[model samples]
Target: MAELTTSWLGMRLESPLVVAASPLSHDAEAIGAAVAAGAGAVVLYSLFEEDLTEELAAPRPSGAGLDPYLRQIEMLRQQVAVPVVASLNGTTPGGWTKYARSLEAAGASALELNLYEVAASPEHSGAELEFRQVDVVSAVVSAVEVPVTVKISPFYSSVPAFVRRLEEVGARGVTVFNRFYQPDISLDTLQVDRRVAPSTPAELPLRLHALALLSPFAKLSLGCSGGVHSGRDAAKAILCGAHVVQLASVLLERGPGYVGVMREELSGWLDSKKMVSCEGVRGKLGFGFTADAHAWERLNYTRTLHAGLPPGGGRPAGG
Candidate 1:
């Protein structure tokens, strides 16, 4: 049988499939099932800075605010032998990051900084936004003893350069491409209807593209998130050099048992390819691994525009 083990953020993972931060992790029963089904780790639903700030500002009873999150981390560590990663979602760096120390003390194996924000201000240059995020990572990494990984969006002007900054700031790993939830307008009510849609298989390519570009040269462990749903998807991610594959939507739709299925599928793929282990095939198709680097970059765009030419090799009738 092909070995399914992989290392991520300096932790040994029995499987590359990780339970992404979502409501699924809110319930201990769900997380237990996932680990039983071969999930390598679980990232608890994020504790937002706004919520932390509000709870800290107002008077509340002990064990009422961030206490539950800390307890959850402690509870999972006791229940499962796998790593329990705590997630902190915020846009800015502040005293709120002090909670990271509490989380670490609570026995969190690692910390994933979910850097979520919409850079809608024209006054703020891309450089400014990027620097702010780097600062946040630095603050958290400095505060925690455990490894810190960054979950970032793909909107940066240069993803690799931004990741380099993160590496310089001491982030242990980087998860590619956080999904930005957009609100829809309700035509009848003439108001914004906030709805978070589940990720589809279509979203996988965007992650693959980004991973292929970064996997070869980045010293930080790369994690692929946002669109993985099958064994093939997981394999594709690993092939592009992802040290781990994070999935939330598929688990939500199919339940935690799906982790075992995806793991089996990855193992079967490795066997068919005559590969001995998951790590053996890692980055086999990444930009650096490929013979033509430009093909994975600009050439891909040109081919996509000319995917299916006319019979006479000219533009279609409409054009």
Candidate 2:
């Protein structure tokens, strides 16, 4: 009943509930289910650029490539009235542009570049790696007429600078921090293993950090998406300056119908707050709004060592 409709990356979304790039959105059936469940738009499973290269031939099952995904994407656009976004994660700039066009032809309303790379090479400096990231985003933006968004990892040293670079390269928006797998040890076999799952709710500080950095830049629309659980969580993201909030973990827990429940909860909260739209509350609680905002400075951690009730409260690390 409230004015929940909004524009994201220049596309009109009836609501702000976007189904994040996940297995659930890989097929027409799931996409339709998401629409029925009240998703504003569906971001197709991230198609890997490596899936198109020789690297894919190296034994392991490759990320399902675009070939098998076209039919699903087409059907989703036809069967659902909401925008259907195409997501791509590629290594080369060439494939990014080519695939962006192919996805557009397949009926995607917009594009999300999950621009990923792990620069483990000692030969390349961090500076070079950052430049390559900018080049990749620029190439994709130049190749696509559809509104473009990029999903970023939290591993960068200068997140704000990285986001500003994406904006300069013509990205319409940025999603704060994609949850990549971290490798841990398998004690039994003494092997490395990656835990593949959504982030826990405790992992919210990173999003808040991103929100603080990107919210002030009017040209950048931020999507704070790391550990959102409920309507209050969603509301908090928007309040801290995210333009949209993407969900993966909560939906995985409660199923697609959770979308409607969260939407309803968000609407009710807005009504209670005497707000008609998300835009009105957006960024109202950001650092700029607080008087003693400087406490957010990371250096405060080292300086604020108060003696506490706990035994080792004021002691040094590992004391």
Please give the range of 10 consecutive residues that has the lowest summed lDDT in model 2. 300-309
TM, every model: 0.92, 0.87
lDDT of 1 by residue, 41-155 (tens): 9999888777767786895564435788999999999999899999988645664368788889999999998888788889999898888888888988988889999999999
lDDT of 2 by residue, 1-319 (tens): 4566766887778777888888887556766766787788888778887666654566445436666667778878889999888888877778888888899888788888886778778999878999988998898888878888999888788887888899999999899878877788999999998768667766776797678757876486677778888777888888788777888878777887788888998889999988989878888767775445455664445454543346665455665
By TM-score, the best candidate is 1
What is the TM-score (0 to 1) of candidate 2?
Answer: 0.87
Stretches of candidate 1 above 4 Å error? 57-64, 290-296, 309-319
Output the lDDT of residue 88, model 2. Answer: 88
lDDT computed for candidate 1: 0.89
